[model samples]
Target: MTMLRDQGIILINKDSEISSAAVVAQVRRLLGMKRVGHCGTLDPFATGVLPVVFGRATAAVPYMSEYDKEYRCRIQLGSSTDTMDREGEIIKQAPENFDASKLEDPSYVEQLLNSFLGEIKQQAPLYSAVKVAGKPLYKYARQGKEVERPWRTVTVHSIKLLGIYHREGFELPCLDVLFSTSKGTYIRSLADSIGSKIGCYAHAAELERTACGPFTLDQTVKTADLFDCFEGLGRDSKAFLSASIDEGIVKATLTAFAGFPTQAVELSDAIKLTHGQEIKVFPDDITLDTVTFTYNNVLLAVAGVNRGLAKVKRVFTDSSAEFLREGSIDEDI
Candidate 1:
């Protein structure tokens, strides 16, 4: 059987104004292929690293989203918006006599940011896509219905003030910050929380995710250049990064799924993996909690470790036919 399309991850420097779903649709259309998904949702107004998964890589979305994320955000003090960002209407503002200088105090900023560094409970924004009874909470919000907002524990790895400065204009004072957080942390809510701590409600004035897992925004390719670059890439070719998929894609793909050290599997193990069986490995040599199974550098599955066994957890592709046709199918999957 002939395969359909290349299966790998595409790192995009997603620009603001486009929804994450829109990016997946665009990639699906451009590649003339289906089975596309995004690693995580980046709000329409927030721009930065957005990973678009294609074909088999779509299975890795769960693994990808579990990675720690990094973001640079600007929060404006003295006013809070209904949606927790500037895009929403102002719902509350600081008193006229509220001192903007408190926002510019470095010591005050450090203390406030430190308070959120560990595990803390955060409430999802009311206008977000969080589900309630199978429908997004935003729908209930729009229907003039109030749902009990659930608070979840999200770890903030670190939060640092980028600088203590404010815009000298009619706009409210702002604080810029760089933070690394675990999955499910809402930066907008954190911004609003920061405002409350400062005795004035605040909202996210601007936000951009700089990193998602191992993919950083600085190393991302602009979404606009993908049409030509993607057209030039072939399934067997390593151009996942270049407008042409580059070897960087191959290297990056190797770790995209489990992000664990890989152990080479014997060609004879293919049939075993297909049957959902575990393979034997030297127990002393295996140090990681999990391992990726590869055959001649072709990644096939991520396996769980127990004693000396490697049990297949997720199989990325079916190379059974190719193995039969070529007598040895060793292409990267």
Candidate 2:
């Protein structure tokens, strides 16, 4: 099996009905080397763009989490579910012949959506993975144990109605919406709250993540294609390719940490550094020593200390291979 040499980001176009963890596992096998991690999580019932970080790019996870997310969602009206989604048990139902006009009134929908914008306190649904006393809240709910969950504040940047449609003489109404929100905003809770505002019950029917930070569905690769690429590469070629990729990651880390200009290096030219000097390298930040420019985070190499000297370190070919071989494979997926 060949390991990836460069730290790069993989944009996966995930489909519904499978857990996010399952997708990560499949990618791990395809790549054949560990140290893979994802930026954000999507529920098993939801699907869309999922960005994966490999090798030193894994260090970018925290920074990625802060990125804005966008979702295309559908909400079914006049019926409420225990979990605040269509998959949950129906807990309440409104009277038949519910006037769809109530939902369309600008004052009504605008008021409801406005309440959710900015900072607001919300209670996470019971059927969630939030931990309580070292156990998941959903785990307790399945056992019929009721627990009080405190409301937490979340930010919603914007919410727009993409479209609205209703079936003639149908009991329920549904709305298609687009959401641009900060991290941790629950679409299900938003649905539940909106339903309550209009004297009807509602739950999420469908959700598809369109974007997360800079990653979008258009840039995502299919799992099958990634697998095919993995199978076609020869072992030696794979090793060499993976090593080269790792070196590129080290260089990027150095550039990021040093706050050097992105164009500082010429094509195929390397950054020079000195041995045994503590130099900071940034993989995702201007400050902080998240990653060091050295061999195994030690043993700095001397490239030169002139004004033109970009911190260059001695390349360790064998160590890069060993690092990939011994790197941790136990990822969340």
Candidate 3:
């Protein structure tokens, strides 16, 4: 088995009961590449779209995290857990008679969700991967140690109450919620906070990521399907590679040149130049005469305009000098 050192975004429909790292390991083994990494971490109990990037595609991680994420979450009201999820031990329970209408009451639920919108303080659950003193918080939690975690402000773009179910024999109501939030927002904590707001306890029953920015569950491939695709490609085709030296790369390079850490920006202004467009070089302190852009560090294409701005030329999959710097030497030569 040969690994395709290819660089591109891989959409994964991550299954439950497996950690995100586990999925990456599987991909590394099947693809026979060690450069595999994921954009975000999904809990073992949660399932849905998990984007994996291989080789130079790992650079896309920060960019992808900025995109809005969509989730379908189920919350059980009236009971609380240490981890704020069903996986944790129940810490508290409230009376079952707590009005189910509290979730639907415009005066209550709306206020609660609204308060959570924009910027607000949140404390992560103890059984989380958040690091404390160089150790994961869960390590302390398992030993029955309590660590003070400062609250951080996170933004919730939108929260919609999808459905409210009243389960008998349970002290509180259950809810199905659809939410779109900025990165780093914890849905488990949100459920716990909402329950607290309503004078009841709650914990997350289920969570499925529906979408993350441009990537969606609909576009994700199962682990099995990915492995099958890899095997079908065979050895020769496994050397797949792709590159793009678009505005994103340019911006990253410029940031690095300016002595600042590279930051990923959503490139909406990048226009693929066609043939015959004028290549203009501005007289500035920072000028990148030629830049190498890659998907996973695999040279895809280079972009620079000719003297005439009338049309742009795009040489796809061709490693020509036009895309290379003056001093760059071709390894093949």
Candidate 4:
């Protein structure tokens, strides 16, 4: 098989109890490549779609990180946790007479969920990687210290209550909810917010990321299947790993840039782009905020159009195949 060592994005169905970084490390070791990275982080206890980029595709992380995300979350009411998730310590419990049935009223739940449909303020959880005074919030949490977390604005595109269910050993009411949110929206925090609105404490019992921008769960390969492919190669391991940059991954990477307006550039201009040179474009021809320049059917660089000139915002080099910036893909999911 031909080694398509160009650029590609592999969608891995990350399993729970493992950090996103662990998944990336496993893929990096299995693929035997150093230029590998991911787009978003999923908590260790969370599972779902994780897009791992290898080769020149790693340069596209910044463009892919801003995509809206979709998650299927399980929120249990009547108790709260220090970490805002099931893995955290139980910090508080609802009053003895607290009623959880209020969540059962579809109308009431819908109204409450609707309140968060637009932009709202959220405080980073104590257990999150969000930094405070140059230190990770989790560090302070581990030391049993509390610090004031600044509130940030985030948008919740949509929320749908799937159903209300009961867990075997837990007496609290559990809600299965699907959320479509802008990047950086924390489902754990949202669950706690919903609990507060319901007059009971709550925490995220489970979380599964179903989609990240153009990448979806259906496009992901199971972690076990990926390992099987690697181990099955035997003496052909190197060749198989090199050829694993299949068409699907290539397509996925291209899809990440599909939102940008495309313009074909001559070979001369393409070379200029890689050298950080600005190129000329028709002043009135600009129709979008940003444009993707291509040469010979391969995406070369992304540019921001101002006035009549196009400035290179990001350049892609096929030979280097190294990550240009740090993003997620290994921290959480």
**Cα RMSD to the true fold for all candidates:** 4.3, 8.9, 9.6, 6.6
Query: How badly does each model clash, as a count of residue pairs?
Result: 9, 19, 10, 4
Estimate, for each residue in 1-333, the C-alpha lDDT of model 3 and write its tens digit: 111224445677899889999999987776567888887788888889888777555655655666678889898988889989889989887766666665656556665767777777788778888888888888999999989975777778888877777777765568888888888778899989888877788999899999877667876778876555556556322432211112111112111112212111111111122122233333334333333232222333233323312122232222232323232332320
Index of the highest-lDDT prediction: 4
The sequence of per-residue lDDT tens digits that candidate 2 reaches over residues 1-333 is 123345556777888888777888876776665877887888788889887776666665665677778998888888889889878998988766667676766566666767777887889789887788888788988999999875788888888876677755546668888888888778888888888777788888888889987667786767776555555665343553354355332123232223212222211121233222333333332432122333333222223233333344333223334533464332221
TM-score of candidate 4 versus the correct structure, residues matched by position: 0.88
Task: Say which prediction, candidate 1 or candidate 4, comes out ahead on lDDT.
Answer: 4
Question: Residue 225 in candidate 2 has what lDDT?
Answer: 61
lDDT of 4 by residue, 1-333 (tens): 112355567888899999888999987887778888998999999999998888777888988888899999999988899888999889888888887677678788878878889898898888888899999899998898979987888899999989888888777778899999999899999999888888788999999999999889988887687677777777254655554654343343455676678787665566777777899855656645678876545566788887768888877654232321221122110
Best-to-worst order by lDDT is 4, 1, 2, 3
lDDT of each: 0.76, 0.64, 0.62, 0.79
Reference-based TM-score of each model: 0.87, 0.70, 0.70, 0.88
Model 1 per-residue lDDT tens digits across residues 66-155: 888999999888888989997899899897787777666789888988998899999878999999888888899889899988889999
* Alpha-carbon deviation at 21 in model 3, angstroms: 0.3
